[model samples]
Target: MSTIGSEGWTLVHQARQKHYDDRYYGHWLGTRDDGQWIIGRLYPGKSMDDGFRDGEWAYSKRFAGDPSTDNADAALTAYVEMAHNTFVWDRVFDQTVGEAIDLYWAGPEVPDAPKLAAGWAGAESPNPDRVVSSAGCSIAMPLHEAKFLLLHYLRRTELAAKAHLTKGVTVDRHGAVEKVRCATGPIRFEYGYNTYWLT
Candidate 1:
């Protein structure tokens, strides 16, 4: 089920802030439909010695839409994998920090099966669910900031996708965002079930 409740999202933010300077990676707690919490993180901008970095868009998609909550995470994860492999990650290396940031936030290639990647087909289009999500992301940041950023993004994306969401929908915090192809792979992230709220 979608994370319509607002509780537990802020803890995700706090964790990200805690690791802002000294650490390049961090984790947060999110929930499933049953109210089980999952471990998630923000987009780790740099590739740490521990291999902590992944594309920002990928992190957001996974953190918010993980399927294990109901075994329905495939559609979102598959699309994210394709988008990252298709339009996100870059091959250029040895660039300065600024240059790297530019690359991460750069516009993606027209995703394969563009209609498939889109959240919904637009009213003007032949298919109301076929329209690609025009909104993309900005420069990469730490996990703390990344999760919060995604909350705003989720607000935007949900609004853009449904044009009716006012504020309850959330991008979720922690959990293993399993790639659709990795049916047998181990869990990507693991954490305790803790929820944080604004109040």
Candidate 2:
């Protein structure tokens, strides 16, 4: 483990030998000059089995084709930032939850009636007064009330995940909440009440 910056948190690093080859290769977590923590790798010699193997292990020319200034640091920074900002974090949270809600509420028949009914029941009481004042008349209901309710529930879940991811916090192997100290501060995860946080 190595400390990246002022946050006093240590980054995780690991090394392993490729199954077919005895050469040792490893990756380490570090921070960019722009204040982003990223995982960097040191590859061994060239091999056809590895995804990055082109031909030889000449250091000067190895990264020449890289788009991010042909710099390992830059590539790692880009990857970590992309994962944090676009793929693994809140944007993904919103997309996944939104899709789930839309799928569930797309059809006329409610997919999860028991769960939906439970939520609706919790929102209101039995014999509650309707909005309409006319005798024996009911208020016109929105066409997608159930869908809206589902969206609300999904949004709440996504928010929880976002909060956790951003706070530099994580759950431990034993199911305990632990503070994740990073150079950028505490990382919060958006894991919800019922979901697994560590994975």
Candidate 3:
């Protein structure tokens, strides 16, 4: 693995192939200058090492007009600033992060209740660092941010476990509690709990 920075954004590029059953899967994960966690989705024919070499591959379609109208699940869809107790989309798509995520979840495709329930749990949770209560009710940000992070954590952890079972080699395979912070404050993600905290 290698670290690269530019214009305040720090990217950690995985410098090796990430594969399963001899099939290569490629994706990117990094933090923007503002301390928000960002991730790129996997694409066929590209290994994680290839993504490192390509560099900023997700922005390729940035100038293709409007992201909102594009339904394609491109490499980099949207990002959130969990640190600030707020979320920000790349504006690369016309849909909000919540909408995009739901669209993918509520589908004609086979339903995975186990996965769906996890997302729902994230939606119902409050900001761990700050929970404002009013009239026996609590207010919180949209479900997308928490859902996104939790899902990613769950997925990566599963992958790591699978690799371990197979006795395969991998890098950055473990998942655990991670925190991201900025001027706004800090957000803590506890993968073990399958939840997150926003301040």
lDDT of each: 0.29, 0.31, 0.32
Model 2: per-residue Cα lDDT over 24-73, one tens digit each: 44333332333333343435534323412332221211122322222433
Ranking by TM-score: 3, 2, 1
TM-scores, one per candidate: 0.21, 0.23, 0.24
User: Could you tell me which residue pairs clash in candidate 3?
Assistant: 67-92, 67-93, 67-94, 68-93, 68-94
Clashes of 2: 17
Error of 1 at 100 (Å): 30
Q: Which ten residues in a row have the lowest lDDT in candidate 2?
A: 178-187
Number of the top lDDT candidate:
3
